[model samples]
Target: MSPAEQAGTQPELTYEQARDELLTVVQRLESGGVPLDESLRLWERGEELAAACQRWLDGARARVEAARRARTPDEAD
Candidate 1:
């Protein structure tokens, strides 16, 4: 299946799943066995997966920060 098709099949993958797939894409690109054209295609897919993973991380960080702020006790003299 094409990269776009494969990616569309997993629109809501967890962070770990996206990360692992991104890593695999990177390794395939770096292995130097794929043709230049194929490598470029993989690179593009890797970029998309990385972006998805980053979005997940950013959202999680925001949630954690919000939770921390909610629990922090106010300082008093």
Candidate 2:
């Protein structure tokens, strides 16, 4: 488990925050100088950040869909 999960306090990262961190992780991994252990750690962190970004996107999509439904006229009169 990750430190945040173990601590039971996942940080509330905004989509942008997660995306930025993920980008950094990818860059570090691509640079090809990190030790194997550190590379693995960065990969794990990248996965977590990707999941966080996905959650944010999913939430935004849901909200947009809901708003669209609300604005549409109900045909079942």
**lDDT of candidate 2 vs native?**
0.84
Tens digits of per-residue lDDT, candidate 1, 1-77, equal 33334456555667788899999998898788899999989999898888778777777888899999789875661
The candidate that achieves the highest lDDT relative to the unseen native structure: 2
Give the range where candidate 2 is weakest over 10 consecutive residues by summed lDDT: 1-10
Question: Which ranges in model 2 have alpha carbons more than 4 Å from their true place?
Answer: 1-9
Q: How does each model score on lDDT? A: 0.79, 0.84
lDDT by residue for model 2 over 39-74, one digit each (tens)?
Answer: 999999999888888777777898899999999998
Clashing pairs in 2: none
Q: Which pairs of residues have clashing backbones in candidate 1?
A: none
